[model samples]
Target: MATPVRVTRLCRLVGRTVSSPSARHRQAVSLPARTCFISTTTWKNLLFKLDERTAHSSLDLFKKDTGVIYRMLGLDPTHVQDNPERFRDWAVVFGNERISSGRHYWEVTIKKSQEFRLGVAEAAMSRDDCVGTNRCSWVFSYAQRKWFAMTNGKTVPVTLVGKPDRVGILLDYEAGLLGLVDIENPRIIHAFKAQFKAPLCPAFGLWDGELLTHSGLEEPEGLK
Candidate 1:
């Protein structure tokens, strides 16, 4: 197991909970048991045992059937896609595939906002299945044979059927495969102005979805 980096301690705000500075050094530190709010930095800060053979063996299976991996996580990963552009702004979409074990199981550093919008079929089948390098984010449109770099909400379209398989796989890792499909908010004001602005507007205060709770487990309509 990889040792965690010194977790920064935050102050306890009226509406927030924070760790004591000493909590960082507590052996078997007590964190919320039912939460999934793991930081990406945590993964990068730690290391685990993963080699080329492990990833290579799983690549074919993931390319052929990612659902099996999804099932392993006990998540019902049906084909659900949400277009970020449809709602406007920096929308981020992701799809999940098998990743390495522990520590850096997945390394997704999305400096730019993204929209989760494709599926295994869309990602794996497309020649441009992978678009941008893990160094940055990218967009993919399987049907249109379109792929491009997405940074700072700016898009750069590209057509690359000539890249190596490593590019596609790594891109997929950098871009989290679509996690939970229905868990989303309409980012575009115009997308739902008429429908949501009325008296019957849906709760717009807190995001309503499956997010990490104070504890570290999955729950319906996660922590408020």
Candidate 2:
């Protein structure tokens, strides 16, 4: 007979402060009731695709010939002056697979870009909604030479010294833990622990002549 999975729910409190480049300060807020599950079995990476239907402000971005990578031009001053609202912020794309439970991992290759956002969002999130700015999503963004983790419309600075060419994401759904890892050094850059209330989909945000490539799914070194 197979062993049963165990689910654990506890009241969890998490807090952090957000700092802006202009020396602005935001207070730390607390999250509650995080859920976790204990599992001994190894989890494998799941294959994913960029869902065009769920993307926002991405009419101009182009997918490369490989079909696994997407590219977009950097912000243009001339275009911004003519139409400020159209391309003022990041363009977003979401993964097709929605994860409700179990542990999963994936990698993204970001090339020659200074700004980008990578993470997961609720499966039901609106096509027009921006990830990391709402309660249903958790994201890590790099902009202006700084890194930040955003949730519930709040942004918290993530302290890391180096920029990574590739980023790895590990989502322990039942354990309610999200981790962002550096592929080159194999070190965790940041981890967000919270009670995920809904199914999650992989998400990416890009702008400023950035090319974001999805590596599909591959088992990490020892997990296989």
**Residue 88 local lDDT, model 1:** 12
TM per prediction: 0.21, 0.65
lDDT of 1 by residue, 1-224 (tens): 12222213111111211222352442221222222222444434222211111111111112222111111122111222222111111111223222222212112211111212121222121111122211122333222233333322234443444321111111112323222112233111111001111010000000111111011112223211
Per-residue lDDT for 1-224 in model 2, tens only? 12212212111111111122231332222222223222324224566666554443332334641122323433342332322112123366667677778777887766566767789987666433456766788888888787777776667678878677777888888788888887776766788889987777787766444554454465355431
Q: What's model 1's lDDT at 39?
A: 41
Error of 2 at 52 (Å): 1.3
Clashes of 1: 23
**lDDT value, residue 169 of candidate 2:** 85
**lDDT for each of the candidates?**
0.20, 0.58
RMSD of each: 21.6, 12.6
